[model samples]
Target: MDTNKVDNKGYLDMELLRFSTAGSVDDGKSTLIGRLLYDSKAIFQDQIEAIEKASAQKGDEHINLALLTDGLRAEREQGITIDVAYRYFSTPKRKFIIADTPGHIQYTRNMVTGASTSNLSIILVDSRNGIIEQTHRHTFIASLLQIPHVVVCINKMDLVDWSQEVFEKIKAEYSAFVSKLNIKDITFIPISALNGDNVVDRSENMPWYKGSTLLYHLETVHIGSDHNHIDCRFPVQYVIRPQSVEFHDYRGYAGRIAGGIFKKDDKIMALPSGFTSSIKSIDTFEGEIEQAFAPMSVTITLEDDIDISRGDMIVRENNVPKIGQDIELMICWLNETPLKLNGKYALMHTSRECRCIIKDVKYKININTLHRNEEDKNIGLNDIGRISVRTTTPLFYDTYRRNRNTGSLIIIDEQTNETVGAGMII
Candidate 1:
């Protein structure tokens, strides 16, 4: 049986796949998503009517599918995506969370945020325009974030009269450029998101093209090993202690597992304190589970009582994370105010918070070209750069490439209480 044809309802369990879409402006990103929703019967009748009425009011001949995702009034009026619009739908094989990111260069922060947790990236290229600078920028960002999969949707094939030559040229050009990137798995597909060709169903328009539809590719892509399951690291969020008579002795450390497999009777260590214990049981509301892994929220009881608290970490005794007060990271400045060398800010990593001082700005990156700019050290809004910082307390972390949850952080301004920058530990 083809699992993709199955109905995704309460009866059938499915894995959730998170993906983000990126492209240049007017490259049919929103329309592509609309087509996916419409053709898959993911949208409700009310939603279809709403967009239809909106299209009529805007004097559009056909229903403006873009209106489905361009939900903000400002975005609809301007015909541009500014903020990241998240959409949810499900096929029989999987549930999907789509982050429809903005296309403009200045909104790089938004794109980064949207793609940060995505397992795959769908980068649309206008068949008429070919590869543009925004294409380079978006692809580089996806590489930098270590996205596991990338599907280049060469869109608007209908405009080019479904020319295979144009598709081959664009694919060749893209292949040459992506050769310099760190992306491991990439696939190219010709599509016309507006006409619903090669989107939800294989396009009959292009007999020369042979590949799975975008939805089919998404449903079957191998994402089972995308998460780190070798190094065990769990940041303790809250300690549960119910002193009720029935459970008076209950003391469980609660957190979402950041990495690795943790099982009952597993030997574990608590960070900063360097205390060791053996796992007693992994508990959930339903019952006791024998094991837990990354991204799963569970309460764990240990055999030995350890002075574990929020900001502490539980890890496998043998494969632990780096502990230090000073580290280097690539930071994307998110605030209007430029970063100041030697300035103090509050840094949050995992469930830990500490004061940190900017030690030095190493270099800035020209995202499009991946070139380092050492001459100008000023890290401003949307600028990605390597910098060193010293934290007031030691942190337990891994390189961001190895573990996203344990290695990413946010810098907050003390006075303004605003998130000024996002960083990935190197």
Candidate 2:
């Protein structure tokens, strides 16, 4: 059985794609999202009726499309997205999980959170506004997160009369800015989320435009190679021992493969203790499997009896990750309180856990302009910075750009237990 065929609702088969939307206030970010859902036939009848009624109540001639994604009561009232609201929709080609993020400067952390797990990022720019500060900031964040693909959506084309010059100007300005960043693939599209142009279907108005529709591009983009398939890194999350008489002798180390692929009979080594073993079998809740890949949780029985527990890593002999207590990281401060110069915090990386203390604050990065401020001592809310940390135990990891699942981590305050920061290993 192909487990990937089962949907969350168990009614359909769809391949899931996680994506994030980013733009400044009034850039039509929410409106674009609402348009996608509405035009794609993903919105419910009740939801549509409610929005229509609200539009009439507000004395608007047309229904407010932005209302569809502005879910919070405060957000709806303020006409802005304050937090990340995840929306689910599906097309025949694929299913989508959208992380609708806020665009306010104070909400940079929210955008980072939303984009962290996304395979692609849709950056909206107002055609009349061209490439502005917020556009630069969002694009920088997408680059910093190492998002695999970026689709620059020049929105509100109708506002600019669908002028080809307007689109070309914004495209040229954005292209220059993105050239400095480490973005992999970039595409530009002219769209009017309000008018349903170039969103789900081809636009008849823009005859000069010859690009795929936004939905078409998303469904066909190659993302199969986004995951690391060479370096095997599995951090054991739990030990599964079926006490039932039928499986009394079964002892399995369970975890989601963070990188690479694993198969039965492969030679593996458990880290920290340096014990060697071979995978006797791979098991899932459904049944045993011949092989498993990154992001899939499975249990492995070893041919040799080895002591492996939670927080330990199972890796291939030749492709082991860095083993060290000292690590350098590019961290984004997510809290309002300034990062303490020598503060101690709990670090959670994959299934491995440990406590780490900040050794130094290297530099703070200005996201909008890509400027590095080395003299800054404070890392307050929504600030991106580089810092060195010393952990109680060695962390087995790779650079975040190589394997997002294995290379990323979160830091929590010991007293409040609040996630204070998110970091990508350097």
Candidate 3:
């Protein structure tokens, strides 16, 4: 291997973990994120100076860490996060993307938006408050979204006198509640986000706790098996045909791998068309590769000239996705406008886009209580509900559990062109 090879291959190979921070009001979610950024030295001098000045203006004794993430003027003025704030940083071992979502009950849609792409979730709980309704709601959403890992940080441990008993009590309560949920791989840590205890470094104050620090756990968590790599699925987003004088015969289908793997000369079939073709070559900007896997973006060329376009799927013949016009999914209504019964909207799944009508509203999920409200068919803003829909054309999809990328879709308002809802096929 060349010692100083160019390109982002090394960075690409490094583990990239996207995690979301969620909690109720005053749970220190923003402060925790600020602490992580500050401890990791991911903050710039200007940013630190700006926050320091802001902190002084607010008459704080110490530099306010929460000022780092609460970037909006309104958020700072109100002292509350109102939207999904994204931050990026990297450790020596792994790169990280943090989605700092709003904790208010009305902003549940924002939490869903932030957690949708997260591999893990850091749910902050004030040690003084233990587990509350918001805690249950956040945990339920994490499980519903199928986050691979979860870390329940018992924050404000300093205020609690760093008591092991308090930590254990909260841990037991959280564990018992999650037992009723579909969540797996949960970890507990006692930390004072304000004091930087057991965040980036292990806390000397809590010597009773022997687990790894938050950063260490985040850096080393195994996420290799999180992606669906068994069933090959690719949705062609674009058809590239460079009509130039030099080598004008090139025809390639461009898309990101939604699932499984693909290689040169692999037998593949195009969905809706029922046409079969063999992969001639897999091309990328960096040169040809022997194989490509899930989440990778590459252009594929078929040996035979077949009619394939955007919304068309190229998948392994043996592992075909479900093809149908009717789909039942759990949708998180995103817009302020209530989801109209029998209303038609533009549904985009993978690269496929089609008009879909709401056929029936089965039930709405009460995120706080984790109960199904079968009697209520009205899904308003931030409501999670099970619904049935019919598409103008058949969709090729897998259940959300099987493939996150291929099994999810967005509902778009045709008139306003706004994304109104996000659905996970069940």
TM-score of each: 0.95, 0.94, 0.94
Predicted candidate 1 versus true structure: per-residue lDDT over 1-426, tens digit per residue: 233554524427788999999765578876788778766677889998998898899898988777887878898998777788889887777889999888777888998999898999999899999998888999998988889999999999999999999999999999999999889789999998888888887899998998888999999999988889999998999999997999998999999999999999999999989999999999999999999998899999999977899999999889879999999999999989999999999999999999999999999999888799998899999999999999999999999988889989999999999999999999
Clashes of 1: 0
The true-structure Cα RMSD of candidate 1 reads 2.3
Task: Give lDDT for model 2.
Answer: 0.88
Q: Which model is ahead, 1 or 2, in terms of lDDT? A: 1
lDDT of 2 by residue, 104-190 (tens): 778999999999989999998888888888998999899889999999999889988889999999999899989998899999999
| Runs of candidate 3 exceeding 4 Å displacement | 1-13, 58-62
**Pairwise lDDT winner, candidates 2 and 3:** 3
Q: After superposition, how far is residue 178 of candidate 3 from its true place, in Å?
A: 1.1
Candidate 3 lDDT = 0.90
lDDT of 3 at 279: 96
Each model's lDDT comes to 0.90, 0.88, 0.90
Per-residue lDDT of model 3, residues 1-426, tens digit only = 121234645655667899998865577776788778867778889998999999999998978777787888998998777788889887666889999888777999999999999999998888998999999889988988889899999999999899999999999999889999877699999998878889987899999999988999999989988899899999999999999988499899999999998999999999889899999999999988889998899999999999999999999888899999999999999999999999999999999899999999999999999899999999999999999999999999999988899889999999999999999999
